[model samples]
Target: MTLNWQCIVVDCDDPRQLAAWWAELLGWRLTHAGDDESVLEPAEGSPQDGVSPDMLFVKVPEGKAAKNRLHMDLRPDDQAAEVARAEALGATRVDLGRPDDASWVTMADPEGNEFCILRAFTPEELATLE
Candidate 1:
């Protein structure tokens, strides 16, 4: 048997808004926007365009009551700068009691969806993993 992963469905109060926010944050293309659902995809012709899964935001009446069981982990070239940019885009830092020296920073989107920003590996660190 074989399977294909199509998209990750996100439940939000406003699908359009949340989808737009994520599209901007990840630089993904917004392929569809409607009242009940919105979708985002990797840029056309990019390596991940068809290879990566899409994000599908769907409207839901209930609010998020707890931390997400599954979340995204993003690694950027500069951790601090990326975190700052996320804040500028309305994402807030979340302290989930992780240790101070933790390699990842927790954050929440405008609709309180939690995701992590992992620290980038230094050149020396990358070489060690090779």
Candidate 2:
């Protein structure tokens, strides 16, 4: 038996809008768009082509009421720049009482789903791991 991850589904009030926002942020293409859901996948031939799972944004009736049990943590080449870009695209910083020196910054999407932006690994630090 084998199981492969397909996609991460996110519940939002407006699937199209939310999906568009994410698509813009991640440079993913909108593979499908419908009344209730929108799907995004990395562009063909890109580094993330098959390794990264698709993102499916589905419409829901109720607004987000609590913190997300499962959230995404992104490691970018430049954490501060990425966070700023996300903010410019309508994402807001979220405070979960983390330490001031925490290596990750918590942020929420337009619909309030939380995700974190982790600090970039220095080349020397990455080399040591290998």
Candidate 3:
């Protein structure tokens, strides 16, 4: 049997704040537990709606010091707008050695976890990549 991917747990100092930021960024639903943990999932009837795994956040003692070994790459229809919106939500631009003509922009959340905002690829481009 094949396995399915589920959940991405991020360790942060403040799960609520980080989770809120992510929820806002993705326009997803946020659920906070009493144990300083939070989950971000696609809202009902939304595009992702129950098909995607939840992004989880849990509080830890140590703070973020290094870059993430596993980072998210998000593709948006309007890359510039999404980047601007993410910045308004406390995400900062990060330079990950990308070229000036790169189609992706790297950004870090308020807690310094890195993720990327990528331009939406055309069907032809995606097919070519495959």
Candidate 4:
């Protein structure tokens, strides 16, 4: 038996704001919206429409206190450009380690979710690492 993953849900103080920030960062589209919830899915006509799972943002009362056990690792086609773009969108660098490393940059979302920005790697590079 196999189970399929649907969406990655995140608890946030403001679902709409967090959803908007993620949607812009990933170039995704808002698929569902409610008073206290929002969902961001791959853009229309995107090849990831069926393969990638949507992100669900839910309203929460408490704030995040510690590090997240699970976090996203984003890979942009252009690392430098994407980092600048994310910074302009209000994401701040958290400085996990190795700020000079060209491989990846760690950043926190508007709601303080820590996620990494990975440089685009080719299939060969991925295989080599594996």
Candidate 5:
């Protein structure tokens, strides 16, 4: 059997804060919260399957350093506008080997998780870029 990809869980010191931040950034909704964990999922009636992926922000003792082994890449419907919007939402730029001419912008979350903002490209546009 083939396994389908599910949620990309992030480890954070503050689960509520990080979940809130990511939910806002992704336009998702806070589906669940607990004393030690919080979960954010696509908004109500959103196309995503109703299963809310736990963004386990477990209590950790140490701070984050170095690059993450797994990271997310978001492509907004509007590339330029979304870049400015994401900046306003508290994401910071991080240089991670992207060429100057590359179309994707690399950014880090509040907890220093590395993710990329790729220009949304149509099938035709993607072919041209490649």
Candidate 6:
């Protein structure tokens, strides 16, 4: 049997604040919270079939330094719009050495956690994934 993906834990100085940032960005609901931890699940009718991993932000004393070892890539319906919206919400564009014609933009969340915003894929293009 294959194991299911449950959650992605993010390390931050303030879990609640980071959780709120992600919840608003992804339109996810806050599922649980504690003094040093917070959890968020995908919104109703989101791509989750009850199996999508939730996002968990946990408190840590250390601040983010150097580049991220792992990062998320987001495919939005309108890349530019989403980028603008996220920027308004404290996200920032980052230089990751991407080529000018690259279909994605690197960004950092409020806590300087890097993630990418990729152009939406067409069905035909997606079919090639399999």
- Backbone clash tally for model 3? 0
Whole-model Cα lDDT of every candidate shown, in order: 0.95, 0.94, 0.88, 0.89, 0.79, 0.91
Question: Which clashing pairs does model 4 show?
Answer: none
Q: Compared with the true structure, what per-residue lDDT tens digits does model 2 show for residues 11-58?
A: 999989999999998899999888799999998889899999999999
Candidate 5 residue-wise lDDT, 1-130, digit = tens: 8985556677788888888888888788877766577777788777664764435555466788788888878877788888788789898888888898998888888888888889887989778978
**Higher-scoring candidate on TM-score, 1 or 3:** 1
Estimate, for each residue in 51-78, the C-alpha lDDT of model 1 and write its tens digit.
9999999999999999999999998889
Candidate 1 has an lDDT of: 0.95
Q: What value does the lDDT take at residue 58 in candidate 2?
A: 94
Judge candidate 1 at residue 106 and give its lDDT. 98
TM-score: model 1 vs. ground truth = 0.93
Arranged by lDDT, best first: 1, 2, 6, 4, 3, 5
Lowest lDDT 10-residue stretch of candidate 1 = 43-52
| Per-structure clash totals for the candidates | 0, 0, 0, 0, 0, 0
User: Residue 42: error of model 2 in Å?
Assistant: 1.2
* Cα error of candidate 4 at position 49, Å: 0.4
- What is the descending TM-score order? 2, 1, 6, 3, 4, 5
Report the number of backbone clashes for model 5.
0
Q: Report how far off residue 84 is in candidate 6 (Å).
A: 0.5
